[model samples]
Target: MKSRKFYISVFILFLSVFSVFGQTRKQLEEQRKKLNYEIKQVNSLLFKEKKKVNNALEDLNDLNRKISIRAKLIATINSEARILSKEIRVNETELKELRKKLADLKEDYADMIFKSYKSKSQQSRMMFLLSSQNFHQAYKRLEYMKQYTDFRKKQGEEIVHHSNEVQAVNDSLLVQKALKDKLIVSEKDQKKEIEVDKKHQEKLLATIKKKESSYKRELQSKVKAEKRVTAQIDRKIREEIERANRIAREKLKNAPTKPKSVKKNEFILSPEAKALATKFELNKGKLPWPVSEGIVVRKFGKQPHPSFPGITVNGTGLHIVTKQGQDAQAIFNGSVLNVLVSADGRKNVLIQHGNYISSYNNLEKTYVKKGDTVVTGQKIGQIFTDKVSKKTKLIFVLFKNTTRLNPSSWILRR
Candidate 1:
């Protein structure tokens, strides 16, 4: 029983080790695949068009994104290689143990066979049994002989099993070693590519620095435009919140049982809306992207301006760079609260999911209008591609009532 327990424990340990390595390796491979896809998208979308206009800032942004993704890919490859190394080591250890166990079992079986051969004669076996003191003793001797034979057969079977295990472990080691080598080679190639991109990026930066005054003026204008759009959106959201709260309060005032005072600045949701909000909250970090395929060029919050050094730009939302003509889709089931036009004539659509509102800005045209219900992944508008810059970007924003939320944290990571 103790031997059986020990073998069971060893088997469990073997399974657990392989299981962990397999899961980690699978995840790394998936991450690497995603990064590779993003790289291809960046090249296809950003580099396909010949530069009709010379915009060093735009080029630098695209190159920076490519470099960032390449770096991630290298890191994932490194992790995969590490996992493979660990797996190979573990397999080697298991193989060694299996080999030793097989040898021990073979030796034990051989000794048993030798002893059995010494009593090969049936007549000698009968005589030995007859020499027992009584019938019960003879029966006991016969039972012992039968159990010994069964045990010897089992030992032979165990030897065969252990031998197979050793072979399997050896094969696994070979596969893992090959994979690790491949991953290492991939990592090196990615590093080289990133280095090349970095050099190109530096050249672009230097060129932009030569025209620092002009670029800084362009950045200032860009910042002002972003701020104007942010203010318009904020005003619209506040108006909607106030209007919704007023209606909710009126309804409660007419009711026989007066509830606690509702917050004037927040949305007073109905029961259905409350349920929807709960579901939306539960799905945080799992919301679909505003666009089907895109890379986030600008994240939420303040960061140094990409074009000009020593200048900070406050980004209220995510700027997702995508292919031209890509449709902006609703991230969840919601009603279109409003559709506002930016100063540049580009359109923006706002969808309300309970108390949470998501806005898609920089659209060429909007398909949904106010009060229109839209489901998850529903096409709401076409993303705008700047003719001069040749960049297609969607500015996506998320909010809980009037409070801003980072869209990246809420949306699923690509």
Candidate 2:
């Protein structure tokens, strides 16, 4: 009975350990998978064309940050796997101990029952009772017999309980062993991921080495492309703003009642337009990207050169890099104010959202024409990829009454 109790305690301890270890292993596996996916994305981006010299330093910095995070995650998972392995080993040893205890309990119980049966005889028991010195003694003997029977019953129950405990401990031990096997596999995978991450770091370092020569050529090309697109869009916007202003003036003059007041750029701010701008502002951090799935490879505003000193580039809006053949959509409901081709020959589509204007440049083709109304998320055109770089970048710009604003501040950040 004492041995049975001890086995039960050991079984409980093993179960507790198994549960804790299993949960830890699961968490480690999840982290390992996430790290692996991130590493793959970094590798894909790294191997794609040569790095952009202007953004190379910044990109390299970002990649290094990701690599650091991956390394830490791998280390954490490895530690967890090690802990699980130790726990599994301890569980196995405890299971073995429990089985031995159960076997000994069964043998002892069997011996006791066999001895009791052998010593029991109906005639002998009755005679022994009568042989007592007095009636009180006989009564006492009867009570002792009852006590002995109960003790035997209790012993039998204890044996069964210990047997059950032994089985439970064995089941837990099997479960722990399986979990340990999974952890081993996860550990190996983490090591492979770390190796791949190191390769990516090496590739980034190599790319950064040739930064000077490449920066000049890439910057010139980017500036030329940006200037062409910007000029084309600006020209179209000027025409539309003038035309809209003229129409509004004519409408006011033709009205039966005299105008209350007329301010330059004032008529452009219609109540509807102001409301839309307010809504767009309200969604400052929540606006969706013009393209569905991509990262903002380039941001809005002035940025330093990746390789040269005293060199900087100004971005009127944002440049998003997406997969080839991706579509550029309208960010909000607006009218297609203009559809023109930039000097670079890429199609540009402009939409007027109330007083604000949104532009989608570097399109291969335009789907909407001037004066057409477009709903939010409406597909306007497909983005064009640079053949030399093989980069599919879309130039997105936002304007209010001809004043340019950074598109990054308005759209959701990736």
Q: How far is candidate 1 from the true structure (C-alpha RMSD, Å)?
A: 10.6
Model 1, TM vs. native: 0.82
Total colliding residue pairs, candidate 2: 0
Regions of model 2 farther than 4 Å from truth: 1-211, 217-221, 224-228, 256-267, 306-310, 406-409, 412-414
How well is each residue in 1-414 modelled by candidate 1, as lDDT tens digits? Answer: 122332353345434434333457888888778888988888887888776797887787777667766766776777688877877888888888888888899998999898888877545777889899999999999999889889988998898888888888888888888888888888889888877886787788778768878877887898898787788889988998888787877888888876565565578888888888898999999999988787777889999764455789887899888888899999999899889987679998989888999999999998989989999999999999988778899999999988899998999987
Which portions of model 1 miss their true places by more than 4 Å? 1-27, 121-137, 240-279
- Model 1: per-residue Cα lDDT at residue 303: 93
Number of the top-ranking candidate, with TM-score as the measure:
1
C-alpha RMSD between model 2 and the true structure: 13.2
Tens digit of lDDT per residue, candidate 2, span 291-399? 9866555577888543344567777888777777889999988788888875657888888877778889889988899999998888999999766556777889888
Number of clashing pairs per prediction, in order: 0, 0
Error of 1 at 193 (Å): 1.6
Kindly report which residue pairs in candidate 2 clash with one another. Answer: none
